[model samples]
Target: MKFTEEHEWLRPEDDVIVVGITQHAATQLGDIVFVELPEVGTEVTKDDEVVVIESVKAASDILAPLDGEIVEINEALPDNPALVNEDPQGEAWFFKIRPSEPQQMDEYMDEAGYLALIS
Candidate 1:
């Protein structure tokens, strides 16, 4: 998993990269109530806002960590937003992207770097 300074995480799977907020971001957001995800095929540049996660605290935007076309969205989130606070790095993933520049992964933070940032 690669992490962005904004707290989004990217996990490459086969030919796509899964996108989600990190546990730290979810924790800070409080209980998530809604998630607005873009349709499949939506193109986004690196750092572009792709989804909005609403919580008791405030609405937060989840940005694309790399340039890509969105391929899939987690359809279950609108009904079960707490999945984000419950399992942020897994079932709570917001979407998957088919990257235009896979090499951009190298620019994201590794686990140790992400942990250090939040600490």
Candidate 2:
């Protein structure tokens, strides 16, 4: 997945779309306390705020990557937000989506492209 400074990450995998926070995001967010996930089957639009990840310092919204219905969420994160801190690319994933607009990925950067922006 590639990331933006906004803390959104997007990865296309077959029929499903994987979404989450970047490692830089998790580090900046600090110690997380709660994770508010959207209900499965809810229709979401591109760039809409879908998840709320709260840290001891502040609360931040996680924006949806593309327009789609939320197929699933990471149930474990609500109880353990540190999973995001522990493994931003693994167990801490925020949600799984089936992007309604296939063109969305084309609008975003590749891993190298994103790294260039961050670097």
TM-score for each candidate, following the candidate numbering: 0.96, 0.94
For TM-score, the strongest prediction is 1
- Candidate 2: residue 72 Cα off by (Å): 0.9
Local accuracy by lDDT, each model: 0.92, 0.84
What lDDT does candidate 1 reach at residue 49? 79
lDDT of 1: 0.92
Angstrom error of the Cα, residue 63, model 1: value is 1.0
List the RMSD of every prediction in angstroms.
0.8, 1.1
lDDT of 1 by residue, 27-116 (tens): 999999989999999999987878999999899888788898999999999889999999999999999999999999999999999999
lDDT of 2 at 18: 85
Q: What is the Å distance of residue 109 in model 1 from its true position?
A: 0.7
